[model samples]
Target chain A: MSEPTPHSMSETTSTTDDDETQRSTAADPADPAASADPTPVPGETGGKFGRYGGQYVPEALMPAIEELTDAYQRYVLENEDGFMDEFRRRLREFGGRPTPLQHAERLSERYDRDVYLKREDLLHGGAHKLNNALGQVLLAKYMGKDRVIAETGAGQHGTATAMAAAHLDMPCEVYMGERDINRQRPNVFRMTLNGATVTPVTAGRGTLKEAISETMRDWAGSVEDTHYVIGSVVGPHPFPAMVRDFQSVVSEEARRQAIETIGELPTDVVACAGGGSNTMGSFAAFLDDETVSLHAVEAGGADLSIDEEAGVAPNSASLYAGEEGVLHGARTKLLQDAHGQIVESHSVSAGLDYAGVGPELAHLVDEGRVIPVAVDDDHALEAFHLLSRTEGIIPALESAHAIAYLEAGTDTEAGTDSEAAGDDGGEPDAAADDSLGETVVVTVSGRGDKDLESVIEETAARDIDGAPDMSAFTEGI
Target chain B: MSNRAVSDRSGNSEAIAQAFADGPAYIPYLAVGDPDYESSLEYVEALERGGADLIELGLPFSEPIAEGPTIQGAVVRALEGGMTPDRFFEFVEDLDVDVPLVCMTYYNLIYQWGETEGPRPFVERAAEAGLEGFVVPDLPAEEADPLREACDEFGLDLVFIVAPTTEGDRLDRIMDRVSGYVYVQARLGTTGAQDDVSDQTAASLDRLREYDVPKAVGFGISAGDHAERIVAGGADGIIVGSALVDIVAEGVESNRSTAAVADRLEAISRELVAGAERGSRARSTGDPS
Candidate 1:
């Protein structure tokens, strides 16, 4: 066999009303705007985050997507008395709505900045995931779907979904990666106790990506009476927008609290980006406020800076290190190889171990509305311990990444400095202080209870000389 | 030389139009390089001999979200057998089949091959490898303009899927630039074997008939009976995927020979072809309701 030239092939192929059709329908290649802005606008009618999110699913699931989109628009977004009221009631009654905006006095003094923690960690199910779960479960009820399916990474979302489903008396199935199931055993047990059948996904590095693929396949197979309660602001159109809308309450409350407590809007809002739910939620209300800087912390995993030996930064910082690609039904910044196959992301926190960031976050990164920072495992672990010691809060490793951002000094990019210095009780490098202004709010996405085992193992492995002894914390259980 | 002639006859609009012109065509799907490469080659040949009008060669990706368990298992086997894009194309280049071969793949594979600045290289490579078109399950029309332009430039057909839920302007947008037959899913689920076709299948096809393109119904189409019923419902062609993948998977599980797998696939393909013919005849004679 010989290679055929493209010119020869095009010449010989049949032309079936080509010129007429081409003229009528072909997209104009000359138009720069058509190709320039790849990210979809957030909250667009069709679940677009500029151009990043759209329904890129199988044909079989199109009806379900449409049905869900229709229901979301009709009963949730537009319905004042029916869907929204019930969702608010459930969030208030069950999910413990309006989680406090606590002044991190001790942590603030340590860093020489007024730091506040958006206490989603204090909410029901011990995370902000309950907010989305409550809202989506209410939407499922409105859509008359009796069964709910979800995919979880750290199991916080799964536990939250299970709680909501149990509260609604709906059967729930949660798909979790085998690795996550092992690491997040506490949350897995919580989900099981809530009556959700947790199916362990063993495919594709056994992480959030695989769990999502498995859950999507399940949704594809059972779209009629089942609703996929996507844990984050990811997946196909409607999901990213819908989840962001549900979690937007986080920022709305934070904004109001900032005004009431701080006497002014926050100078900077920080949140970790793992599929970017909390980040989008915390940043959504402050998007138009140019004065309020938005900082998104991605899990740096081992290291994000260029390492000579590895030849690449092994990190989940898609906005910083990844390129545009489609994953789990939406086009977003993905941690993909040269060949576009998704590379495995490593993070101490399973919640941040995702190859793709949410489309809305990707859009914000493009627009420069959100500054993307990647926090390394060591710094995140340091933040995890520092919060526990100073603030008496054991933050989820995912949330620790956000605190690591502040610890690293807001001005400098995360994972840039190799030295771990936050726990020395000395002020962070003066350079670090200049970048992060006073009055910063970090979204404490979840409590660290589900991540205690992984944290213990990681902390033990690090064995830093000045690290806080975690022995007392892990002594009992 | 015979293979060259077959390649020349395929990969064009005329061939696909001709296949559907006679009657309702039977298009059988096989995950390329499943079980092993050589076995997959034999399976393709058997499908052609078994009267397949068109063949959908599935290039298995690491994650096939649109697929059901049967196709997913086949993909796992294919990947385990080391079926990379280069090997998949090499196999296609060597295949001496007569039927028009449309590659079924995810968009990422194509996106990965092309540079960020230029026309997609995958479309050019696919044309050179003797593929007629693409059936990217994940590339919706909204995100499909770039690929569609590449396909237009490469002289390849870009098939679009019309689901039961696709209506109003979305359906129009999908059908607007479709070069090959439109893929009509039988139900609201992934590809798998089903006992009966849903009533929505008929309605979907009926809705699609207003468009000028030929319609091929797939997803959950398992048996010859399904083929018959779907074709009778006015589909210009029947695309059977998971059911055929299951046969190959069963053969591999049972440790059957490559020829045994080929033979089994051939038998099933023949049965489906017969059913398509019967359904075509029934439609022509006004015997189908």
Candidate 2:
């Protein structure tokens, strides 16, 4: 069972029983052990994932957050106006849900284990971002909101939110860091084509952190008519629990598919974690299964160290090297300095270039229920090439972090995955992991179409062992 | 764990209360080390010289979500000037102003200040730095227990902002944790200068009638007339931020001397204070702005 929050923020439901959630969903008729929905029961944890989550926002946002919290309880939890039912239907018809769980035959042979790919990459808009975006946009409509706003890092969430907004005919605006807009130009084009105005955030490092702050500033002013659909499960209250509920369909379906295909739950479930929507979603249903080992891979940009004088961290591995701190509305593991100022995080993949992770994921890591691993840019790049050549699928750079973990166990030059996954506050190279077992399921979080430019540019700069011949394409293709 | 390092929390709160006891409390805010450390210190001193009551020294966090471009720009300048939490405390200690000073920043800086865990370490350090209280924009009362406990232990006051939308049970919850003066948001948005006074101010102030805390209005109180209107609408005090910082930004942009910038701030502070006093007299005489 999930632990109680250190401080519960429930005045309305404080008198209610802690065991009974304000609203509980009907159990899936399938495996009862896979129903580990940690959508913080109000009055029990409020919005906390232990000591990490709360509504750490300005007073101006309290009304909106409370309204959203109520709407979350009604529309999302109780399925009022058939909101969730409609959301699920849209996922199947519009977002292309129940994406295939393909057995990577070649990858299985290479890893000497049965490797299954939970294909979120095949979802419409080329990523798993649509699940939450579509749900939140729909929730906004149910709550009488006329407009939507969001933040994006790699532009996947931006594109997905833009697409959902267009589908629902709601005016949409997406705030993206200026650097990310320049790097992820194709995705920017996608958002604009879907009729969403893209606002470039020119603050602080011009990355996800800046974009989120900008979006929040906009929401603070326009919250009466507009809903800020947070891109990940990192923000205040209801967003984390609500987004997890929306995205948990990933693990729900993956678990059922694994049972149908391989007769039981996979021994390991791996996914790359940035703000941890996909990671939490993929692990939510498997959390109750004692035998299932969950692995969350993080981007290790260049190295694991930070430049104190420069206030810049070389990597985005918060779980690997972070202290407990509040960032982006929640207290979670963050890449910060001796002083509390958040350091700029780096990663070759724009999606994983964030200083904080999901509060729930941090709690799970602290509980020793989730294994956190880091894959440096070089290894992630190599894994990108390896997956494309071996599986004929060019994975997004974020997903390549997970793909790299598989190789870390076998790749001689690359470090072992076991050693990287250990967060015992010791040397990272001193851990052991011999229980990856037979069947492993890795969620391919997104397609690499938006990453083609980054891939070509990065591959040309480095000597990736299995990268395609780039002599003809190196001259700015 | 130790109160020896902390000044009496009531001493600062009493100072704040004493400031309010005389006339309309003129609270001015500026991010510490906006352009440079030396200039920021001068600017704060100028506020005190201009009849300021309590002062808010912004400890710039890397990400200030509640700030508009004006204050965001100020934060950017302060951060670029190498303003860390340690530097902020040092800057606070350096301020020679007589008014009780409070630190306004995000919760991250408070939660991660000291070598040990939790807000106690930060609160102890803040109390030692001669700060009276804090005005963290991001910390709502729901997540304020730890910080509240820390402030109580340190004898510092914990302030909460009550926006126009706050009401009923939620308002009660916030009011319970509020000490020092409550920051009454004059409008429904982030901190910035605006053309007209918000009509929502009267209703918000009226809702807090039952709460005995001092109501200091802020947000969009750019000019002296704005301050007058807010105080006339029944606020115990008036708080101004971005408009003053805009002058600082202009000074930095025009490459003006510190004296010139600080002189401009002092003039505006006097205007705001005079206007608030006029409103206070008008309130007693039953006149509207």
Candidate 3:
């Protein structure tokens, strides 16, 4: 009954990393997250950590990406003290950093498992997207790029990019897919109000790919004068690498706090994956530690059985239906056909709507260092509501996918309706104790403010229906 | 087979089909993601009304490679207006402009769609939605047969291009098998305003005429003057791209206030049409042609 006291909700999945620092000044020990690993990070500038974060761009855009890399390096090198001080200051004051490590007391008691959350939702911009956007925009300013261009899927990146650009007083342009524009209208309006030009792409299937293509086109046309700020850890070299480096703040903090609070490292690390930002950010530091199991849960919209979207089927399944090929200028697993043509990608979370993962994460997944799991939209929704009801914390729909994986415990049947309510109409609480296993920690990446309407509609519908319909929706193909 | 017929309902099918039969090369270009789909309908209607002789509707891919800044800005606007292949087809279907709507698009999109997998379903879907032809900017004349075959089966024109950089044997081959007018790249660049119409372009037109094809010069023929000079230089048709894209730009810039910008664009289009008509008349007479 007293097994580590089931880990206080705040101490469920602790990550205890060594405090040793790299000897080289090219490495910063004050930035403990970036200091944990001693391996060659991966790419040319930093260790690409598996080919995930190389600079894969057109020949014309290389100079721009390199310029950004160089500027970031120069800023980090010359103004280390100033930059880190400002980074930490703004992150705390402006970005609302050091978001609390909240213990889910009620959930821990109800499920008989310690469930703690690293609440990133408390960050400004309502998600973890700002972590990198702020870093990159500041780097762009340091690089002397007068303007920035970016692509958005559900408009989270667009809004974040616009916000960062506005704060920096740099002009911003966002390329969005036509479909995403309609689906995420409010974000579009928000970006426009923020003084960013919203260019709707009217080609192919109006989705993330179109948004990415248009971003590339815009960058190609203006690579000389603009910085193309990518949203996630995907894209070719440097981008996947750079975004992770910036977002690594999440894991860095998580690892430090885990040791400081729990006196050890966590047994497991879990986060959601759209373009795999939070997951990568949460797991990058712990990658080489063979003891910690890193889990990345992808959206399984309605049917957990299916690997892709229903109506608009795509060929990409970097984790499930992809092969190792080059796409968007980097060599990673691509969801392309034999001939290398891109196929549509599907995920419940707008942020995870990409067909590929960050190259570094892909390498880790390929090497079996990290475990990959898919959670359908319906279950993710359940996790979303569960976290809200249990902890009074509403997480981003994207982050909910990861929570679903932790709550469901890798067995699709574990979180089923029959398990929740029981076959003979027994009380729902009867199976609660049986379901709880180990200390479960979920990364609440961002606030659900952006997804509040959708969550309300989903929960309202579920309340009206009396139960979550398992058949009508489950994470599937 | 003169490019003088003007009827919104009819793009003078008999003349265009005859021109195809005579091996008259054609180059038709329109901003793919054009004036609002509503305005694109009008521009397509105008091309039909002006007897474009052979129509090329730019596919308005999210990434347009052959556009200058003016056309590029309009494309950005069209994309903003929810322009997708499905919506574009819907616009084409509703427009009721009966002409060979050759879809001028970039390569990556078609490649993404797996052109070899018979993008015909998409093309047929568009054709069913009332489109008639395709001219992907990146589809070289050498690899044009499959697209040509798909169009041929559907009674559509699979048009090809002859850039200024196109050489002798390739030129002769493109001229020989090209069905719709051979898309004559008037300049060494994308579709937009040019400083001046080159004399070398005139020489290229003459060289093309020697192949006995009705050649149409495209890329940057914007104003009435440019149209007149093109028609005077032995061009049977003057295809306008960014000029049309500019009208679209004007309409979008005015918060999409249709009437004023549409009227202004209509007038410029009419002048170019009239200028082309006059040049055609002069050439027929061999007097001031």
Candidate 4:
């Protein structure tokens, strides 16, 4: 099939004014209470997203949480001139900010959509995680804390934090699960080379959850001199709000760049959600823009269907299958069993292998501001290869979930052509109208270097007679 | 029965008030079902015989974030012995002991039972099982309204912790709602036996005395000297956990019989209880300075 021109695709959508009118009338735009107030009101107990977020920690850590919250409010938010300026300087000189928003031409043609890739994979630590790390480490310094600690699943956050600590001349320690350390060996080495002490946690299921619990324990003991720079938008009050504010630059820049490059905002914005930092960052700017739909793709592991008794397939989609419960200090949607014991999550991408998501995403999901979908391991693996071959950009397994959704035509309503663009199948597109063509932006949250081993192993297993039929694997799904 | 006048403070705070009115309270902590449920019961009985004023029953959880290695190991051993929340309550309901029992556990066990609705289920069950109060190490005073409300409705005192780092406003907030003796953390770290009482313990106790609640110092009071110093510094009770838990762990590691472990625990409990008595005498005589 011949590829359509970008101009032809752009012409298919309605005028910008008409689109804006339709979107404003489609639903009650942003919650005035949330959008109008930027800073946390004084005496507000916990930084809440609707009713989803709260500080549910032990008494031993309350004083520390209070101290950190005070410091963050006074030094970082109120006096941004002193702290945030230095943080932004470091982000520019050391962490490489203002990353390009590149148009994925070949892949866009294959999908018959105008797809733009926010190039966070080109960041200093090869992921968008450095944005939060640099900003938080700066705040730690401003708080007069000489030591820093963090927890990691795929080690990207650990590597980014270690790099920031090295730059700031602070002693850094990172807690990682023993299972994750083995899989993400390269990033672990990178963290060690940056002078971080990587402590391997062996408690519980030995994954991200255990690492976070261990980090909290360490902070409880050494709260005076150490600051725990939580990697994702999870955890207690100031952390989820702070990390999201630090990462908001991702969407802020992308929103401006989309208008500058394509004359208007993309019809839909997509990102992957684990603890939901990148998703929140990519969706924060467009939340008030009713015309732009926000979609988050979660790791599906095996299947996207729910099974309460067996709890087997699509084990990682907390928003889809989880109930409201408290975990690691926040009350959010958690993948828990009937007795409230947290169930172990399975995902090929270690970054998205958590059993809980950020409470803010939970609120957005509840408000219908954000749509969540799940893509299994098979589809993500296929997208990981397709992006490399078509766009010459190898995306992290977590980001590949977003690409997989596009390939599977699951997000056609949000964006893309309804004619089933890609080689998958056009038969499913007969029900929807093909006249409405929309532009979509997918966030390449990180580089795929850490996942090369798993990808090679998976490809080797799918090989038939020493030749891998990549198309055959992704055809039916 | 003639001492009934001293126990008339209030129905909810009677147990702690009576214990404090008599003398310094010596509280020993043991993880319930550690090693086994039957032995755990014997340990509690031995503590009561050894003159313990009250006992803290620990509910073992898979993740005890506020615990040091000593208590963490005990929790692991208890869970390995197939202890669950249901079994813990069943054993506690039938436990025969003289001293009042307060549960010391992480918040997740209670939170899991409540399941994001409220902490009423766990508090009600604990009350049904004869528990007098709860000390959730992780549920701070600021986020404790739900559990505190449940505790009040169930006629249970909710004990709150006052750490060395807890200062002016935060200390006042924690002390205001505390019904039982205030749990004063002697040091800046997790539960373990330290060589000496923290230098800040004296000042922390002095600050805690500004409030009306009785103070009990914990988180490293192992030896008699440590207990005496804490109580002499104005602490109404001395809370010891790791030292007693270490005895249970050591006994299990060395293949000692349950009776031997109980005897060892009782012997140490007697020494600490004597130290608490001496400290009480010093406080009454105004001689610690």
Candidate 5:
């Protein structure tokens, strides 16, 4: 009924807050409909990635978030107290830095392109999650925090965070969705072996989203003594930026190796996008490289469309078909309803079943700097067996989404409805993409040791090409 | 200090201050539609019948990170009962309660409502539906300008929380914009009932002595004893959420009738109201309680 003061579209923090006086300023009280190019000044923007990220948490958490924002600025950005230096040193010695970039001869010959694999699977916890986990746990130590909490969907992050917390000798508790705990039992055992308590979250499908909410609820009370090592780049400010900065070493090393090994930068850099930690990590250093196309492969679980009435997205392709909405603190591309309720997302791989993606990745996708593609369970399962057989590498089902895209490409003609290419039926998993260029870098985000049971059942259920004979598994592996 | 939220629409906005003017206000909260729409309306009206000075109706949000297990359960039940923002407005219209209603929820629902962006649409709908004010958990002072402006435009009060840890420049920022009341968190945690009233409640109330708004303490306040302690410690109002929700949950679990559950809620509300009044009597009569 009345015209309110038009919130300025630009970063209004510079006017309302005394920027020089303190770095612990709150979210901008002005325009949330951020402009096209959200500047990367965390201080001024309060951690917005082009209107996608900000502090959307309770006031009880404001002091804790502000303290974290201050710590992030001083330690992560400014390298205060030699935080970055020590972090890198521990990452190299403890977690194994500069994981090799191996050229895949079998995949290269099969695809007629130079396919290089960034061996993050060789890292200590067998995934890129440790990169951020170690960084956050270390940051907590510097901030005098005595305990650390993390949420996991696949147990990759949980195991990695548990390992980091154990190595740091800090008490750690991980919140795993009850369903994931039942599925990823081995990784759960590994976390327990690492001396971290795993708490099962039983709310709302018991997945990454619920686990994250549970962990945030814990942090709301225990913020003084504990640090929440958010496993992905999806949460509020400082988390997305901090986790990205920590995991960016994946791309930094890959970028250098691509130049040195290939004698030029690769034409494409591919990584699987879940909550988009690995995707953002692998794409961080390559964002300015126009020649290098960054492909973020999302899990198209069962189908691409959302069941609006049922409130279920049969896929986790937030980057591909999501609308902007807030889920876990940050406003990002999410598989939500028209009413802004976050719908349940599905994926054969627990890691990629999340409904929302990293805010920065969402911004990049909208800006045309990154490309998102979805691979269904059938194709991803085949790719898992293909990689294990061809290259002797059992890629995680989450990582297999990338390999599936590498083989089938994004042209939906090669989908389950394969009549587009006629009855002649092209290589079911080998639909070609000539634009992937001469050299391609795919990040093997994790080893698939944890996904053996799921892969066997999934591969057997669908007649996935290249799946190993299941006769021996008739009696159970 | 400026008495900004004085009311014209049946004195609804001014009713907030009046709720606390008599004595310590007994504010009880419940999800808008926990078990079902009809029963929830009965539960709220039951609170009014039981001597509730003010009421906080939770607009069920999917990701309520600020809530603990109890309130989170209530939100889930409410959402499962086909509760949406539009449905909540309709609920308010159907609800025949005289206690001033404050919508407590997250920022996304408010920001994403109606055709155009910002809080105007939701606040307009809320005001039109006879809501007095709002208590958005996620909308901090830094990100509170839009909501504040919209509330000011529609003559609804915008209340901010002052946590036990809140102080220094941040506290000043919150105090500058807060109206109707300041929700003083009794402890540093998510909202749910606790066994004992926090010792920090008195100290937090003392810290907010200079602010010129009704200071309602919430978080971990469950029993009538908590109300007494908080009110005796100089709190203007006591906000109880989880304890009442627990009764509803118990009623649903035990298969009690709507009237039975409503009767239990009314009894608890009376107990809480009496507790607060007792503390107020002690305060004014110079009793050393």
Candidate 6:
């Protein structure tokens, strides 16, 4: 039923015999009469539920992709013999699941706000990427694939997948962009140590996109022997669905924990959107809960808006400059130019330096299901230093962007007040400098072990011989 | 149907099958126009001497869907070079090459030729041209029956494709009446130079074998090395299209210095043809080992 063509990349299996006419949409989880829905909202194919996942590729690889998609679907339906229970057991006992939700007592009491941390950083690979990698590796094993191939940025997903593949004794190959190989040297070493062949990809841009290109090339060459374990929920058809299904446990657990602690889901759900895995995973389970507002904070480098007069632009703006097109063969929304060429995306965090988000997320933005917020680089650095000093959590710069938005709304009023009333208070110098008030849940995405130098340099920039003009740095935006 | 479009039915399909079944499979190519009509007649004789098992008579259409920029450009020039349906058939009717020939053209041109009886006039004219089959790149397997019926009446095979993406159901439809061989699209993206044959081609060939049809992969098969890969991957025939077009284009590029360019073209084409013949033997035997 699936027509895998260049234009139709995903494994689009029609539910009905007359399937060729209807475009696949995401399925709705709660609606029983979902098929009767007319429009494809962001999440469900029609109701923005779940039916929309498909593979669109060149005419060559349709059969293979269809086989895989059909296999995964069959596995999902038939493997009700406590597969998830067993998976949960393995993750909880061996790989470590239910990562603690830490109370940021310091930040909470200091500002009159309740700020808690979902410590995905404490998870095995120092980021939330491990959760999905573990799940995918399990899925591949169940499917009888002997080899695993993946592309990685910042080496977090690559290292985690390497660890899983090694534990499973599955031969693993990780494609890293030549640029990323240089930028994330430690992760590359970790992957090597974990018994993964780190293939340096020298293709277009030599970043995540190039790494993906190399991975696809590897796949096209060895489709029979390999299972392409994509890092995020952003590739072709089933990857976005599969990875999201795996990462859903994050929010599932969070929802349970939140309800047990506070009697209901949080009034506001916030996470950083790097390919939107953690953000979407954390917000997905509670999307239709009208009271629960979802906020995805993106990295805004020197400036949130990119204009000469605005000084510098924020890096986390995928849709702002992005157009709805295709990248890596899937027709989703992409950050492209008017001529449909992909544009280079910027973000202060290495994890966030991607040009495209998951297509479902684009649909969410289209249907107005989610609100995207961008935070500047300087503010993210300030947040990183503040979280580290005040809460003893060296939050990743990627995570710091979420923290930046928590204070972004206070930019103008707090800017004037702080200019008039300087940080002459009795607190650590770092926390005092970052004392913009807001009751916000900033996702501390990962530990900042990778960002020590950048943090040091930014902090060093503050001690310019004199206090110079402390008033200049008081704006919240 | 004009005289040019209709091919000679008289045992031509049986002859093509007989050639493949026996020894020395003939692989002849026809550019829309070469030198003059007299030269095209000479070219057919030249192909027969060169040991062509089956002749593929090129139909010069204005727009060829699967042709690369080079072939497309040449086709444009070939048209401007005074190749027409009437002129094309008049030349073909004169040539007495005993081998079976397949007429190849774009669907739009065939559609424009108008319909006669069941199939398009082009297929009818293909029978008049003394060809054995018709290769329409734009026509899908589902819609090939009209041409198939016409080709059957005229004793021409309506060759169908099984692209890399063709699933089992689609493959079944494609191989149901496929004659000559199931033409395989070699790669994704617009066809040009393919350094390495994609694994999808192998999968497509392997799957097509289930239907017991001979598989022939074409489009962007540029090198001698590519022929080896195609053969190794279980392809029954490797149709090298772009590389041949490049040779002819090179001849045009170097002015009308026919002897020099002809030497290069003949040498390359001979080497390629010989390799393809060897490949067909290897694949037929099912022992690349």
Kindly list the per-residue Cα lDDT of model 6 for residues A281-317, writing each as its tens digit: 7766555443445566765555434442221224546
lDDT of 1 by residue, A319-366 (tens): 777788888888789877665666677788889888888887887677
The runs of at least 3 residues in candidate 5 whose Cα sits more than 4 Å from the true structure, single-residue gaps closed, are A1-45, A410-435, B1-12
**Per-residue lDDT of candidate 2, residues B211-263 (tens digit):** 78789999888888888888888999998999899999999999999999999
Better of 4 and 6 by TM-score: 4
Candidate achieving higher DockQ, 4 or 5: 5
**Can you tell me which runs of candidate 2 are displaced by over 4 Å?**
A1-45, A411-435, B1-12
* lDDT, each prediction: 0.79, 0.84, 0.62, 0.79, 0.83, 0.61
By summed lDDT, which 10 consecutive residues of candidate 1 chain B come out lowest? Answer: B1-10
Q: What is candidate 5's CAPRI-style docking category based on DockQ?
A: medium
lDDT of 5 by residue, A413-451 (tens): 433321121111111122334336667899999999999
Q: What's candidate 5's DockQ score?
A: 0.50
TM-score of chain B of each: 0.94, 0.96, 0.82, 0.93, 0.95, 0.83
Candidate 4 docking band: acceptable
Provide the TM-score for each candidate, comma-separated.
Answer: 0.85, 0.92, 0.58, 0.88, 0.90, 0.62
Off by over 4 Å in 1: A1-45, A305-314, A410-434, A465-477, B1-12, B117-119, B285-289
Task: Tell me the tens digit of each residue's lDDT in model 4 across A151-269.
Answer: 99999999999999999899999999999998899999999999999999887667898898889989988998899999999988888888987898898888878877887778778
Candidate 1 displacement at residue A415 in angstroms:
17
Residues forming the 10-long window of minimal summed lDDT in candidate 2 chain B: B1-10
Docking class of 3: incorrect
Would candidate 1 be rated incorrect, acceptable, medium or high by CAPRI criteria? Answer: acceptable
Model 6 residue A41 distance off true place after TM-score fit, in angstroms: 15
**Native contacts matched by each model:** 0.65, 0.85, 0.01, 0.45, 0.64, 0.10
In the order shown, the chain A TM-scores of the predictions are: 0.84, 0.88, 0.79, 0.86, 0.87, 0.78
Interface RMSD of 5: 2.0
